[model samples]
Target: MITEFGLSELWEPETRRDPHAFYARVRAAGRPVPQVDPAGNRFWVVARHADVLEGLRHPEIGHQLPGLSHGEGEAERIASRQLISLDPPDHTRLRGLVGRAFTARMTARLEPWIAEVADRLVARARELGSFDGVADLADPLPVNVIAQLVGVPEDDRAMFRAWSATIVSASDWDGSATLAFAAYLDDLAALRRRAPADDLLSELVALEAGGDALDRDELVAMIQLLLIAGQETTVDVIVNGIRLLLTHPEQWRNLRDDPSLADAVVEETLRFRGPVEIVPPRFAFRDLDLAGGVIPAHERVALSLWGANRDPEVFADPDVFDVHRSDVRRHIAFGHGIHFCLGASLGRLEARIMFDRVARELGTLRLAADQGDFRLHHGGLPLTL
Candidate 1:
């Protein structure tokens, strides 16, 4: 019977500024809170740690209801094929094809190069004496790493970064940036067909040519997911991790003294403030019971990862940012179940390397001034070294 608040409250400037306060109330309600989105679509928010975990793995819940038409627009058609938007056996098939490129071992192979990239970025920031964390270090490192891994040419990476920023930040698709990105990938695929390279895009292009493995739209969708999901969320993790450490001076000193604590810092940051407040919306295929409430058939269900990560029952003193927390691994910031983030290993590696290098090279750092609350896409995070 949680009826007082809904999605409108969740989207308010005040709530976005301090979401955990809203989430705390939702979790206390002891059930899935029903909500109506701005579009007037009915949905439910699953907030508790146990409930969110179960919702992610539930058999009756998915991206789309069973036996429903995919949709009938260019954007909808393309979006339906994305890794994040599909259910099994399509999800299983696509993840299998792309998973080879992002395996833990493959990610490990890139660590030395990733560390080199992090070192260069940190060294340049140190030389400058004052730098914006987002623009100088957090942004470029992942863009370069993921671009190279995806076979996007170094010369065109600036354009790629701009397109990503545009598309992700837009409230509505409008399809302008997406169309341009698809066209660029189309050209890149043509090039890879003529001259294969040692990268993921070239591999996908080969699969598409083989006839049975992939289609043109699926190929573009895969690359789009890899490029955007690969970099955007990781940027948040890195920048927010830095923001947390500087704000928590004692934690910053802890990492400064022991650079190896970078991995712990990444974990704690994900728990404290994950990049994704809610995972992309899921749907209830039939009337379903979860978290002591029932969601009607075909209704949208939003799983709040931020809420679950801070559940006090799961993480002791969950509000406090602690790099030494024993249960930090339980946080599902990258998600759980079948739709888990394909780039988790790579994201972790990149963040760990960047934090370690910042600790070793930057020495001591402080925020230049008050920059208000940290945002996913922000102007900058000015820091004085």
Candidate 2:
């Protein structure tokens, strides 16, 4: 039997810095822990690898659940615009269409451009001898790449960055953040309709141009969802991946010495500390037996990607950051099943380009400061990169 614990206590600075230890304690509790968030919504957080996969595979669960929320009373507000907050035929239809535009072939086609962009960024960073990984490399690379991919003009990328940051705030979506982003997206969607271009927005607009296409509201919501979903997580992956490699000199040396190891290096990074600590909340639609317990219908469940990836049952050491781990490919960072992240290919390509350039250009890169306790930003690492 597992002793229940408080969710708020788990959010403390010490826990945030070393959350894996917290996961261990929760796992040792023997079963999935049932808890309520600060907002009073009840949910089960599965902290062990086997349990997490079981929870993920349960058919009764969904991306959006009644009473499941981003934070506080913001469920209604978040649900209003993001496709992630929906389910079934509605979710499938929207996702299917967007998937057509963000296909693996399309994303892979952007690789050369991604490499060119990474080369430019590294050249600029090299001139300074050392630079912040997030600001110099992570933040700009994906933001610019996705911005261009989505058709936001070069000049408006600053606004895209600001809007993306606000929408993904780790805490809550309230006050000015809500109003400003809503207005910005509303206006931007209108602009895309008026002046189409060779970007994702234009494709969406063209879809809307046809009479039986996405409605105005769905179009706006989809745009907001794609922009935030596509950019923020990739930024963390690149920044955190770079931080992980630098901290582990052996891994860094391996990547630098052999350029072909870039792909494995990225997979290892995702396995080690890929961004997004928790997968989006999933709600149980019906009572389901998963790993010996019955999760009641209508209850909420969350799978900890961080915990599952570090699970000893699956990976050998589970804690050490090893690029050469044979089981690195098993990480569930991009999730599994039907709702797997649509942008995984693009995100992978982006990471590959960034790593390839880093290895080729910045030979023997080192962190300017000794790595400190990584504070969670947007619910993931904000290691000063």
Candidate 3:
């Protein structure tokens, strides 16, 4: 019998194609594997919806893992300088300062511009007939939007996109790439200091002057995190959602018939094939009970957002991708609690506009070739449409 959370033979191709079915097997056991990895790490996989929620809500489980850094424990280098890296009182203060920048009103105000961008992209896609969704659609839109918000110039978007990619690389850090990125950011900060604009970066600079505290290091970290977070995962959501819909023609038709369903479809797609398959690893601040096991302090806890979203106890027919599912919003695709994604609203808006514009402008959009194989960026999604 396969023990709960037992290491199985499925880890290889599953990482390449789909990990959902594999997670279903573990979830069927109704408990996380007693201990998934070696090193006698006490962490358990939380596959049940209830268990995931419990783990996410637990106060003892914090996001302060010390050993997560690479290359001789570069703790000072990798930790996010933004609000996300901070735990409590500091987190609350920084988040409060930046909350107004991402308000619904502000995002809504950008709708016309976003729609225009979507329309232009869709028109370009039609001209090409077939394009890699990852490169053409999923990758660029969010990068463009976030660049505008952060005061990056139009010509600099390419370099900014490359920098975002390098910083978020799961493999070894590219020294030249990383240093160039850091230097660019330092220059950007100095530019803002010299002549501020009416963007979020400028606003942050002003805030810094007004006693809202964030040093140069913190600012660099915040900029890097925002650049990657604002663009990368969002591109994954759009690409993955499009891939699934194209394969499931019926669901695609459901959205085509009624554009109002696009929002719910976005939510369901996020549940089905979200970009951040797992939540960022967290540290056990103290001994904590999870999934019928005790996780000792100093150990790491990884949350499977993908697994939790598809738990049958919470979602009926969890494996089936259904846009009409009434419980779609219950999914933890955007996560829960204090560390929930800050740019979620912007992501949704981008998705809705992109889907609508694509479906409307490109009347006969479909997969380019059945035999073409696509690549997945570890913990990321890709599509060709």
Which is the leading candidate under lDDT?
A: 1
Tens digit per residue, CA lDDT, model 1, 172-257: 36777777888899899899999999887887767765664667788878887877888899999999999899999999999999
Model 2 CA deviation exceeding 4 Å by range:
1-8, 63-78, 170-195, 375-385
Q: How far is candidate 2 from the true structure (C-alpha RMSD, Å)?
A: 3.3
Encode model 2's per-residue lDDT on 267-376: one tens digit a residue: 88787787767777777888866644666888777678888888888899988988788898889888877667878888888888888888898875876666565433
Best-fitting candidate, scored by TM-score: 1
Q: Which pairs of residues clash in candidate 1, taking residues 3 or more apart in a chain or in different chains?
A: none
Ranking by lDDT: 1, 2, 3
For candidate 3, report its TM-score: 0.89
Instruction: Please provide TM-scores, in order, for all candidate models, with all chains considered together.
Output: 0.95, 0.88, 0.89
lDDT over C-alpha atoms for residue 348 of model 2: 86
Error of 3 at 103 (Å): 2.9
Candidate 1: misplaced stretches above 4 Å?
Answer: 1-3, 66-71, 208-212
Each model's lDDT: 0.87, 0.74, 0.73
lDDT of 1: 0.87
